[model samples]
Structure formats: structure tokens, C-alpha cells
Target chain A: MSTRTELHYAFALAALCALDVAAADAPVAPAHPLDAPAALKAAFAERIGHPVNVLSFGFGEHYAQALVQNAAAPDEFDEYEAVPGRPLEPGRPKKAGEVDCRKKIAFAALDLDAGARALAQARAAAAANGYKTPDNVTLGADVFCNDFGWRAILTSDANDDAMLQIVWAPDGTSPKAQELHDGGWRKVDVAKLLAGSAKVAPAAPKAEPKTVAGDGRKRDFRRGIDADLARLEAEVGAPLGFKHIGIDRTQLSVDVFQSANRKRVSTWLVGDDGAIKLWREDDTIPFDCNKPFAAGDFPLAQLPDLVADAPSRIPPMPQAQVKDVAVYRSGLCGRPHVYIKLEDERGYGNVEYDERGRLVSAQIQ
Target chain B: MAKTAVAKILLALGASLMLAGAVAGAEAPGTDYGWPNLTDFLKQLIAKVGAPVKVYKLAMDRDGKVDLWIQDQAHPDLVDSWEYDHGAIEGPIPVKFDHYPSIAALDHHVIELTTIDFPRLPAMLATARTKLGQPDARVVFIELERGDSSGFISVTDTPIWTIALDSPRHDGRVEFDLQGRVLDVDKD
Candidate 1:
């Protein structure tokens, strides 16, 4: 077996052994399923038939109730659950096997300042389990579960009736109930049935390597930047446009504009006092700035007036009360100007007013 | 996404301009202000925000007006206003927080940034790392503010120290008060 596969298998075996010990040590209980997360992940993967990413989950609740509904085909259906953590729900103590399927749950992040601590905890748990979660997030939680980003949910206090009903909106208040037509669910295989179909378990990958800031060394910042730029040019075989640089006793880093239009870019860094070799990756920007600077649509004195109501507000989202528009004090498309963008639930676009506050141009996508 | 100290300082410098405007009785909006005087105020503002990071106020030379916030200062590593403006400056509008798009150089290459209290950075970072119980974590960036640019600043002259830390587990940003107590921690 390859090193990576062997490493993963060894981990799986060790986890299974740990679960066995925990279960055996308890006089009259099943194992304290430390491997429960892995099992659940494998099971979801089997059902999805794709390399399903077990994104994130809630905690605190002792169990998860998986419900299969709207089976388009015998195999094609939807899964939903309700997850609650501590303090949010008066959860009953687990009775060993009682912590099986038929309950949807998650842990609680009781951060004192977590405006949506429970949701944060759930997302964190998912992150820990190797799924994707957004950095900018919001949750509208009431006494029970509110409509999250799902078609349905599972749980007793869940505002939706499908984890019984789905509000299809963040506003899950007074949702139309999905009556348990065929006795909803009583037989959920949960983690046990997927034992055979489960494959390699995936855990959260470690963060990419990066350099730490410096420890107060005395050196020529400009020389270091120049050297690095020369090195980059040598490696890439092109003249790199210098965009930005920061040098101090702690570290030296630089960004380069890689395109003639000036939208393409890359970054280079020398960390650990140049102990680590620098790395580079190129990228591009969308607002094309190939054209020469011209007199824009507005004058300098009325610059603020242009942004006060420029048509750049895109993708406006009133659902989570996320303001859709934002003004920028930066340039775009290789031009120096104040740029703005508008956004909502639909789409977004960009607008650039020249440094003097004249209308340069705008593009929406 | 935090406001730069220089921007705040330039705004504070406006206080003096306001007083001068009042004294000269030239505060009226319609008064057509011309060069030398018009040009001097812009120069002072450029100084207020510090140099090499010029605020491109566009072409308001035709009008007696000004609007600038150090927009074109080449911010190292971070595309200036990347997080704050939601990527409207570089790529498409409303870029994702999770999306740290690879950047290549374009119009700017190196930006000269003026700092205050930079000498104390090492000690402050050490304090923050120890307090955070992240001994292995590294300080990726820092922002140290002592006083505003309008000159003497406040009566107490409180300094703000914000430190950014990157570790294998997660990224953390913290602010320290004058007494070195942690003000807040941002989990990324």
C-alpha cells in the first residue's frame, strides 16, 4: 500500500479499536462512538453516490434522525435532519444504543459573544470533519431551528416539519407543516447499514504552509525585495509588475502585477528570516483595464454624489439582512479610481468612478 | 477590513482646515478656489496619510472639492481593501471570504508604508501569542497605532495594537488594549 493509503487505514483501524475499547469498558453500554462522525460521513458518501463532502454538522444533541423523503426513484430521494446543541434544547441523557438514528443533533459553541453560537459550532464541527463553510456567515435562530440553507431538516423543536417541513427561506417563522403522511419515519438505518459500503474516511486537511513574521532583525528591506523580485523573474521568465511590498525586522513580502492590462497578479514571501524559499502563484482580475485612463462621466467635486447612488449595488439580500451595496476606495482594471459594487440574492456587478469622481465604466455579472 | 490610522488622521487634519475655512470666510461651497491654495490642501492631506501611498483624488482640479481615503496605496500581501471592499478592487465584486485568490502584480509593485511604534512589535506579538495559548502560531501581520495624525492626538494618548496570527488549526486576529489585555479574538 502507498504511504498515504497506509496512513489512512492505520488511522481507521486505530479509531475502530478505540471505539471498541470505549464500548467494552462500559458495563452495560455500547461504545462511546468516537468513530461516529467517520461512520456518518461514510454513510452519506454511499447514499450520494459521489465523493460526498460531509461539510459540517451541529452538536450537543445526542443523536440524528435521518429521513428519506420524496424518492424520485427507488434510490433517488432526499435526506433531512434537525440538529440542536446544549442549552438550546433540554436533551435527554443518552441510553447507549438510544443515541442511534432517529435523532438529528450537533454540538453547541457557547462562546459568550457568539451571536449565533450554536450555528457556529455546527459549522465548526463540519469544518473539523473536512467540509466547506463560509467565513462570512449568519443565522436566524429562534426557540427552535429556523430555516437554514437546506430543503428540509430533522429534529423535534425544528421549525421545519421535514428534519417535517422546509420554509425554503431563512424566515422559518410559521412554516407550513409537512404532515407525516406515511408515519414520517420509524426505521432509519443510520450509521450501521453503511458499514459495508463505507470506504476511506476523510478528515480535515491541515492548513497550507506559510511564513511567520520576523523577530526584529536588522537588514536592508529594499535589498531583500529586490533580490526576491529578481529571483521571481528568473523563475517565471518574464518581467513582473511590482504591486505591493512589506518589509520589517520580522519579514519581507511582495505582490506583483503579471499582466499588461494589470489585472493579473501573484505574491512572493520570504519568511523565517529567509530560511524558507519563497513560493509564487499567478491570478487575474475581471474588470479589464487595458484602455488608457480617460475623463470619466463625473467631475471631481461631485465624486461623493456619484457613489451616493451609483448603480453598483448588486445581489441585494434582504433575507439575512445583509446589505447588498458597498463603496470602495480602490482602483480597478489597471486604473486608479474609486470602485464600488452592488450585490443581492441574484447577481452582482462593479462600477468604477475615476479618481476625480467621474464615471469611468461599470460591468455587471 | 479595519480603517487605516492614516485615513483617520487625514480626516482629523480636516479639523484644522475647517477652522481655517471659518476664519477666512471662504467656507461657502460656490467660491471657486484656485491652485497653490487648492493644491496646498491636497499636498497636506497626502502628508497626513503619509507618502508613497498617495491618495489619487482623481481630477477635481476643475471643481473646488476633494474626496480621498488613501485608495491606491499598494497594500502588501492583502490586496488593499480586499476584504473590506469585498474584492471590488481587484477581481469581481463581493468576493468570498474563503477565496484568497492568487494575485499577480499589476499597476503597483512596492508600496512604502510609514509605521509608528514598530520597535515594540516583537514584544507585543510575544505577549499576544502566549496569551492566546498558541505558542506555535506565527505572527503574520500587525497594525500598531499610537496617536492620530492631527498631531498630539488624545489627552491619554492610548495606543492600539492589533495582531494577526496564523496557525495550522485556524487563523486568529486579536486586539490589545493599553494594559496589554486582549480586547477581542477573531476566529477565521
Candidate 2:
């Protein structure tokens, strides 16, 4: 063969090799940590200072399969079935023998020393509440806005005894209060009750005369005179008008204010055509006809520009992001659903879309 | 003419045979030279080095990238090991396997150590030394066979302090100094 022919063959071989190398270097999805090297186990143990086991709890069955691939002896790792439990529903009572009670939500157990330190901290918190633990007293009931914190419910057979339950904020701020439920646990608006109790007493009322002596004929004549006056006013097309009836302006104003307060704030405008229109505001309060009309409801044209710009006047589209992406299969549902978690600063905001990609009711998870 | 052509061929063949012999002689242990498995090798090394230098547990470092350990006679229970890849360490240092064959000859345990950054070994060793004190150290290099008909080699060097490996095969020829603490390893 000529030198040129040899060079051509060589160039073709080189091109093929380059393509092969590029194909080999292309990035595939990364394997889960279990399929990782035995070295990873050692690193985890060192970091956590305990025997660390990475387990899959929820709907991801593929994770277990991935882990088997990297096992040193092929299936040497221990596998345990997660206990079946009901999905958490807001305001529902926790059932007896629920698997969720046994589920280990914490990443890892604290070492002995760390556990001791935590216990000491808890003791210090308990002492600061002006009540000792294992004490007996009837806790005064009150309601306060717990809005975003954990409140514990402590119960004991001793009817008058009370324990301090610590309410903790996510940012580590915690306050302890004595438990107060007597028969059944009830949630009360403590702030409102305390405000009502702080009001001062009112003054006494005056007595009125029981009777007056009058001739029956004079009474009948006076009544006839009143009826004649009313007839004369009706003929003239005008009724008698009061001059100084000692009107209570304060009470009248208060009645108007109360009626306005009962009214539901205007939310988004639903067109007469029955289509829900998108608004530009952050929040929308739905309009209810049962509520008394308030200042919130002026004609859209009469509203101030700022108020009109707000979400109640014009509802804004929900803002969301993909917080976590998990793939799950439902035999009955038939199709795989990609659960794209969207969350703001709130713990777990509403999941807006359903399996069919349509807007559905928001569920707080 | 036939005799001359034959002689020319003979001379060429002779030169080639001699070159092959020279290359074989220069081959590193665990390559051309044979070494046993890592577990057996470690046992033999500990026996040769003598007691008080104990080998306890072993672990791969973060992400299986490196192997590191600490060995102290005072605390036989505690051992530290760190492993790193070529990217994690500075510079390219070829794994030397001469010291490994002798260590392996003592026992039959084999551990595959892939090519790693030499500088990372020292950094990890420094940390272990601070925790476990200085000890004699030795590195065992092994060649791993891949499924693709290609082979990649790695080394696992143990910093063993005060312990000495005495054997007729080694003849005290292999040794390394870690910050003035010298570990005399058997190269043979």
C-alpha cells in the first residue's frame, strides 16, 4: 500500500477512537450513595461517630436496587420493611400503635455525651418557668397565637396537677407554660379572653315612677288630639319630625362599625361569565354575599390605585419552585407522578397541581 | 551466501533476547515481581516488624478516594487511615511495589490500592501521626485488572514507626523517613 493510503487508514482509526472516548466520558445520572464504594461507609462512620445506615423510607423502591449493585458481597446489607402508617392530616387525632410514632425522624442518635448535654439544657429550661417539675397546681387557661411554633400537651391523672410544656420555635427560641386542660383538650383564644377580663365595672341604674293619677276622659281626648294631628300631617303629605330626641351618636357610629367589621373582605373578582380571572396581588380573599358590605367593596373603578394593585382586587398567580423531585408509581392511578415540592419560608406550603397537570385545591403537607 | 544471511539473523535474535532480559530485570514488584494479597502481606509485615506495633481496624477514606490509618502500640484499638485520588493530591508519583513483595510473602491477604496522589498521603499521615504518634510506615502497591482488558495499579503505604522488618530477602534495603521518623521497610 502507498504511504498516503496508510495515512488515510490511520486518520480514520483516530477519528473512531476519539468518538469512542467522548462517548465514554458523557455524564450519566449519578448513582445513589449506597452503590458508592465501601470507602463511603467508613467516611460516614467517622463523620457521625456511630454505625451509620442509610435507609430508604418512603416510596423510592429503586434506591434499594441501586444499593445492591455496590454491596461488597452482593446483598450483605440488612433490609427492613418500613412500617405502614397513615398520611398526616391536619387536626386529626393520632391513632394508637401508629407506625409514625416508631419512625426515626432524626438523622442519627446523639452520642452519650451529647445526649447528656441536651438533657441538661432541658432541665434548665424547665427551671426557668417559675414552676418545678412534678408539681401540683390548677393551670389557668388562656389562648395565645401559637401561629408558628410547637406546643406540647402534657396530661396526668392528678386532677389539679400541672406540668410545663415547652413551645419551641424553629429558630431555637422556646417558652414553657403550664398545662391546663381539665376534662377534654380544647383550643381557646386566650388573648381575647384576657382582654375581656381586664375591663372595669359600670355605674348603677336609676328608678322610675310607678303610677300617675289622671281622668279617663282627659286621656281619651289627648289620644284623639294626637290622631287628628297625624291625620292633618298625612293630608299635608309630611309626618311629624323630631327636633331634639337626645340621639346617641356614639352608639349609632359603633353599630355601623360593627356591621362593617362583620363583612368579609373583598377577594378576587369572578367575572359574570363564570371564569376565574388572574389578579396581580399576593393574596386574594373571596367575596361572600353573607358578609355585611364594608369599605373593601367599592366598584373596581372607585378603588385607589394601590388597593387595586393589591392581590384582593387582582389575584396573582401562585409562585412556586421545585424543592424536591421524587418519582413514584401508583398502580390504580396507572401513571407515574413527579412530585415537585414547592415551598417558601413556611414549613410546607400547598401542593397546587394534581396528576393531570390541572390546578387543584392546595394541600398543606 | 546462505551462511552469511543465517549469521545476520542469529545476531539480531541474540541482541533482542538480551534486551528482553534487561527489561524483565528492571520490572517493579507486583508487576514483573510477584506479591501476595494485602491481608497476608500486612500480617507478615507486622510479624517481621515485631509486636507492640499493632494493626487494628482498617477503613477507606472519604468517598473511597484514599486509605489512611493510625497505628500505635499504646492504643491498639485506635487506627486511622485516609485514601485520596490523583486529583486530591499534588503531583504524579508512580506507585513503587518493591517493598510490597517481601511484606506479602509473610501472609496471603491482598488489597487492591489504586493510583493515588503522593502528597495527600503525607497530609493524611501527618494528621494520623498527631493523633496516634509516629510509627514505621510501608506502602504496598498492587495492580488491579479491569474488565476492559486494561489494568490500573495503586499503592497502600502504612506509616509504621519503631517497628522493623527483618528478613534475608529484604536485607534492610527499603526504608522511608517521615519528618525524621524513619521506617526501615524491606524492599526485597
Candidate 3:
């Protein structure tokens, strides 16, 4: 190619490069801050009759995480402020006092006295609307603000919303307290803001066993023996007879101790099958006399059937009135258990079970 | 050839520098609102209960509210429990008593009673044991109160039952047998 042609090409390329450089250096317009305080104040005035001054503002992330890390840390009020001349540089650190008056916005504030009032109003509003707050309230010192400055956040009884935050900081200019003023304050849907602040209800108390009225005068001495015998027959799938010598009803639990102490035979008639049937020692099934009773030879499933057919009379098992199922746990085997106490005119019994299947033992009260 | 390689390396280096500059320019610092501080609440509860209490469980409900279960050395069965949101007590504070089941199907036997008034610890304990057929079991009482946001007064301790007072008040007590039976329940 000719030198003149090469020169023309180079000039065109140089012009293109210059244009790209200029475009790269051009500045873009900055975005508007959220201006949370102004928006909130306006919202509060509009929603509530009175204009509110935000005593403080809590950035949820900062407050929640900080509390988890150091439940004792002082309240923080430092926030990001857009520097007037240097938009491209890191913003300046504005203290809570400075931010209260800063022009470049998107910040939120918590009202001290006004905040408390607003919270009271909000809680009343919530209660009327069927929303329940937690029962416990916790507050800390206003470290960020001095005596003239109030520093506190009102969480629901459950500490959910941090619903109301109050910061009474020194007027920066005055020593005496001024009539509580509403800075750029905003009204928040406390329930909405505290959506995650529901107190966990305590696990429902266990139900007491129900006592049934029976013949209080004459006691059935054979009831315990009968329970034991029926339990044995059901396990063995046959009848096992034994002479009932005596019964001990004086103790809290009525037990019929049999004469099997002398009999070393593995075929000994275990009087009340209920004990063996419900016994879960190392997942071993009790001996079934119906199937030719043997030590640890019966299937676990048969125990329920045996206990069901037992002639012994037992009181109804107590049922638990569980208001919250989320924390329910069965007392047996440390598993989640739910007991429905069945009661009729005749008597009552406890039907115990869990999310899985039937447990090894169902005691008849 | 050496000159050409050097020129090529310089071009690659220039391109990488431009890319790095562009990436750095796009990054921005984000703001974060920290978590709340609950030390004051715990401390208040310790002071109010007038006993040494340990937090056994801390749970948040579906709505993000927090519930604390604290056990006092005096009353292990009776847990001083409370729930709170931001800085306010959401509801009434009450004492909880534990109960156990008598039947074998129930496991880890425990029953709870809640009352507004403080009751005699011994009476509550005795009633629970007798109902559950566990007379010789140990009993515990838990007391709780709602304080200003500064802190909470959740007192838990074994009642000495050394002093006898004549008054009708609400209180809660829990009874658990050695075998984990929750036999009786009495609550105001």
C-alpha cells in the first residue's frame, strides 16, 4: 500500500480511539437515596394525626445481627452520608445526631417519646385487628444518646418488630430538654415490620390422668392378677392359670406380686400379662403363653392385642391439652408423643401414640 | 521474534488492567443494620428472680418473635418462660409448672402449670407427685415478671418452704417422678 493511504487509515483510527476515551470519561447521574426518614415522617403524619419526630432509626440487618453477636454492645448511630462534592468516593460517616439533620436522605429514624406513643397506638391498632404481640419486653440504655437523648427500641413482647425505637439525643445546641419534637418521622406497619417477631408459645402442660369412680368400698382383689393373667394368655395365645393368693392396693400402684418367685421354670405363668406385654427392655417381646410361652419368644405386635383383651379394669389415661403441636414430644422413649385421653360414662384410658405408630405400652389408668 | 513477544505481552497486560479497573468501578459498599442487643433483658430477669437462672432454650416463633425458657437452680421442673418482640412485653407473664404422665406410653414425662399468682411451692409439688403416683420425686418452682425494656425479671429457684404465709395467690409448680411420670396438676 502507498504511504499516503496508510496515513489516512491511521488518522481515522486515531479519531475513533479519541471518541471512545471521551465516552468512557463521561459522568452518569447519581441515584436518589431511599430517604426513609422523610418518607416515614410524612407517612406518620398522614396515618396518625400528629407529626412524629424520629428519635432513632434501626437498620434491621445491623440491629438484629449486632444483638446476636454482642447482646451488650452500645447502640450504634453511624450511617452513610453522601459527600456533596465527591459522589464517586466512599460516603462520609454521619453520626446519629448529624444524620438527623443531613439533607442527602434515605435514612430512617426512631422517635423517642413520639415513638413510644406511636408504638402504643400501633399496639392498640394491632390488638384491635387480632394481632397478638409477645408478652415479654426488653429495653437497654440509650448509650448513643445521653440523658437528654433517649435511646431504646421497643420490640413486641416477643421482640419481633423492634416496633418502636426512641432516641432522645442532646439538641446539640441546647442543654435543657425541649418539648419532644418530631423530626422526619415515619409510621411503620409494626405487625408487617415485625412479621418475624412472634413469641414461641411454651409447650403445653402435660395432662393429669383422670380418675374414674368405681366401687370404693369393696376392692376387686383379682383385678391386678386378672390383668397379669390376660397379658400372659394374649402373649402365649393360650390360657395360663394361677391361684391368686393376695393383692396389695395400699401403694399408689396396685401390684399383685405372684408366687412365681419359687418357680425357676421358663414356663412360669407370668400372672399379669400387662407388665410383660408393655415391657420394652431392649426391644424384646414378652413370652406368649398362648403360643407356648418362651423367654423373649413373642412378637411385639401381639402385646397390644393381649393388653386389649385383658380382664383387668384400669382407669382412663390422662389426655394432654396441647395448644401447640410444634413442640410436642412424647414422654416415652424421648420421642414426640400425643396422648388423647378417652373417656366415657364407664371409665377412661389413655391412647398414646406419636407421629410414627403405636408405642410399646398403653397404660389403662 | 523477541520484540514481537514483548509487544504481545504488553498488550495482554494493558487489557487485564482495563478489565480490573472496570470491575472495581462497578463495586459499591452496602449498609447493614445490626441485630438487637438483649443482654439488658437477661440481666433484669436474673435480678428480679433473685436466683441463679440459666437459659435452657431460646426459640423464635414462626412470626420471628423470641421465647426464652430459663431454669432456676431452685426449680428445675418449673421453667420461667417468656416471649418478646422488639422491646415490649407482648402479653401477660405467668409461671409454668411441669407435670409427668403415669402411663408407660408417655415418655420423658413432664407436665406444666401456669398461674398469675405465686403459690406455695410445697403444695404445688406435693399435689403433682400424688396425682402422678410419684410421691418421692423432687419439685421445682419458677417465677417470672415483665419489666421495663431495660431487662426482665425471670426468677427460678427451689423454694425453701421455710416460711409459711397465709394468703391466696396464683403460682405454678411441676412434678416429675424418677421414672418420668407426670401424675398431678394444680394451677391458679
Candidate 4:
């Protein structure tokens, strides 16, 4: 067996022995899962001195090889390989016919946060197994690379209590390998990617989690939501429409979509005090929903005027209260109209009108 | 005739004294117009009940009445709340209290109203008013609570005072520390 396999074997044996001790103590919280493929691709890109899109990676008993294309200069394909204890180095050029670089890759770009979680878990796992973790390797690193792009071993349970056997199968035949192969790859900045991942990595899971604000109670996440949105709008321009608002105890963020197409335009991270702490423009197509809203059609200031006679016009329910009002386009690439919602004892109703205050549609249910 | 003139002088002095008393009442630290402000209400209640085990929250509604939630000193597990409107105190009513491990471990929410400096409230409100730049801006609500933006959590023992205003932009919530230091001011 190779030295790398022997090292993994020792770790497996140590983890098995430590399992009883771990069980005796309070149960450790589950580690965040890591993205093995993304880390491998990042490490590979760093070694090759170019951002690369990895197509397929194959491992043998002695060595590992990856077929990749330069992300910057398309059509410039290369193959890299590494043996145990050595970093990846260019093995055969794609033009030499020795390496077959396919255009298709199975996975997308990696979520760097997952990578950070992986790193943390790996470090914990190493400490648990009584091994001195290397500084260069990430915590809970699912994939281990040699000095360069020469060799790597991918394992699913590297950080698990009883370390699973490091699968050294050939030609990516394993089910896990196949799944990774089918997932295409994308280019990324390894340093920034790792740093961002590290920032979001949760503190090593404790036997007892630390108490955060709003513990043991259902917190009103929207306590200052309006103030936060207003602050965000003051900083960035008004959003076309809200695509998503993620509110939890630890974090709050709003995904804003702009333009008539309603493509996601930006994201705003909100602080506890309802301030826009950070504003990040949409770097990727996170959402593609075609629902469009004309944010400019009717400002909130116009709602009072538009719904002046709304209660009188909708006679099905008396003493109806205005609940919500929004501007929505009829169809993709259609004109914007105001939709006012009213609620009473029976049910809710919607009253629609154009910007010119012309009644368009009214439905009660 | 000379004795009558002396009597008229005495009457004029008495009227002047009454006017001075009225001016003093108007300028009282927490008196806003003819109504008792939030600080005055809190001071009266705290005097009657003593320092609470913990103060959960306090808020003023549109009617200018104040509602307070405090952990009952007699029963640590229970929360006793009250509503104050127009010089009337209407409760020692039990309220929803969620047991929290953090709060139980450390009584971080306990507040000694007697020790708290409440006189600086007017200045703080004035600062917020100047920042808002709205001539008609008025304090719609005020609260002393844990967690600056969210609901309960043992974030700090130093209680926070949030004053919300009904402004044209609707961005008029101001936060101040117990000592009246401005913590945050939402943009107008």
C-alpha cells in the first residue's frame, strides 16, 4: 500500500478506538459537509498557475490525472498528473493526443462556504484522531492533494468519527466519483474562495451550543424589516421587486430583482438594527423566475390615492381593511398595474387598477 | 384706602407664584404638554413595584399609553405587565414568558429603574428630531427592550431605549443607550 493509504489506515484505526470515548461525552454536533470537487479544482487551479475548468479526473493505484481547460483562454486544454507526496505537474499537452480533454463537465462552481465548513470539520476530525493537522490543508478537507496537481484522494467521510475507508478505485468508477464527474466545474479565485468560506464557517460545534439572541423564543425576524429595507434603498436604488427575503436567527438577507425582465439584480445583507450592512451585486444567475413587477409604476406614496375608493368600489365585504398593495405586470413584457388587497370577515379580495386610476380587474375570494 | 392697596399687591404676588408653578410643571424632565411622558410613567411604576427581576419590554401605543412587561419579583418564572393611560395603571396581568437558558443562567435582563438616569430622554429625543428634519415629527412609540432590532435575547444588561417616529419616509427609529448615548438613527 502507498504511504498515503497507510496514513489513512492509521487514522481509521485511531477514529474507531476513539469512538467509545466520544460516545461517552455529550454528543458532538454534526460537522458541516464540504464540497470535495470544488476544493480539488481550486487546489488544481492553484498548482497549474491558471484558473481551469476540470472536465474529468481519473485516479489509479499509483497516480492521479485531471483533464482541464484554461478558463481564461478557451480551447487551450491541458492534462496534469501527480504521484503520492508530489504536487500536480503538466503531464501531457491536449494537442499531443496523450490527453483527451472533453468540453463537458458535470458540476457547477463550488459554494465557498461549504469549503470553509469542510476545513473546520477536517481540523476537528484530525484533532479527534490525535493527528497534527497541517496548516496548508483545510479543516475537514474531503480531498487531499499531493505537493502539486499530481495526485488526490477524495473521501466522503474524512471527518466522521469512524473514518470511512479512503476509496482508491481507478477511472472514477465509484458512485460518488461518478456523481462528481457528472457535475460540471467552473473557475474560481482560490484565495478569495477559501477566505470567504472560512468567514462563514460556524464555530466548531460544541457539546452545548452557545446561546445567541432570541434563544428559546420565536423571534420576530421582521422587527425592523421596514427600516432595514428603507436604509438599503437609500444606499442602493429602489429594487424592482423582492425576489427573496431570508430571515433567520443568525442572518438576514434580501435578494432584490430589477429591470422589466425581473432578473435578480443584487443582494443586501441586513444588520440587526435594520441597516444595510453589505450590498453585493448579483454575480451569478441565482434565480431566473420571469415574474415582473414595475417598481416605478406606483410609489408607495401613491397607494393612498390609488386605493381612495377601493373600499367603496368593492362592496362584497363591508369594513374591509387594506392589507397589502403591490405593482405587478400582467404578463412578461406587459404594462404594470397596481394590485390592492383587502380582507374582511369572509375572505380576501384583490382590486387592480392601472397607473391612470382606471379599474382593470377585481376578484374576491 | 391704604390697607386696600396692600391687599391688591398681595393678590398680584400670589398670581405670579401660580404662573411660576405652571411653568415648572411644563418644563418637568418627562412632561410633554399636559400628558405624562414615558419616563415619568416608568418612574412612578418602578417606585411602586421596586426593581424587577427582569424587564422584558416596554412600548407606547398610538393612544399615548405605555405597556410594560417585567418579570414578577415574587414569582421569578412569571411576567407581570401593565398598561398606563391617563394617570391610571391597569394591570399586574400575567404575560407570555418563554423560558430561555441564557436568561436563566445570567439575569442579564434585570433592570434597576431607580439607578437608571431618565432625565436625559428629552435631549435624546431632541437629537433624533433634529436628525429627522421633519417639522411635524412626533414620537409614536418608545420601548425599553433587549435586542436592538429583534425580540428577546440576553444580548446586554444595559437596557436600550428605542423611539419610533411616524415620518414621511417612515425611516425614523432612533436607539439610545441607558445613559442616553445615541446608538443608532435611521435615515429620514
Better of 3 and 4 by lDDT: 4
Cα-based lDDT at residue A178, candidate 1: 34
For every candidate, C-alpha RMSD to the true structure in Å: 25.9, 33.8, 33.6, 28.1
Order by TM-score, highest first: 4, 1, 3, 2
Better of 1 and 2 by lDDT: 1
Residue ranges of candidate 3 with Cα displaced over 4 Å: A1-237, A240-365, B1-40, B51-53, B57-64, B76-80, B87-188
Please state the error at residue A95 of candidate 1 in Å: 30
* C-alpha lDDT of residue B23 in model 3: 28
What does the lDDT read for residue A21 in candidate 2? Answer: 70
Q: For model 3, state the Cα shift of residue B107 in Å.
A: 25
Cα TM-score of candidate 2: 0.15
lDDT of 1 by residue, B12-104 (tens): 445443333332313223222221132244334444435454221111122223222233334422322211111112211232222222222
**Cα lDDT for residue A228, candidate 4:** 46
The clash numbers for all candidates, in the given order, read 54, 40, 118, 20
Candidate 1 residue-wise lDDT, A1-365, digit = tens: 89999999999999999877754542221122122334433333333342211112322224332323122322222332323221112122222222222222221211112223333433343343333332222222322344332232233322223222222222222222232334453332223212322111333365574443444444443222444446545654566555444343344555656555456555666553543333555555455333322223214235345544555333222222112222222444344454555443334445566656666666443
Evaluated with DockQ, which candidate comes out highest? 1
CA shift at A75, candidate 2, in angstroms?
Answer: 43
Interface RMSDs of the predictions, in order, are: 15.3, 31.8, 17.7, 24.2
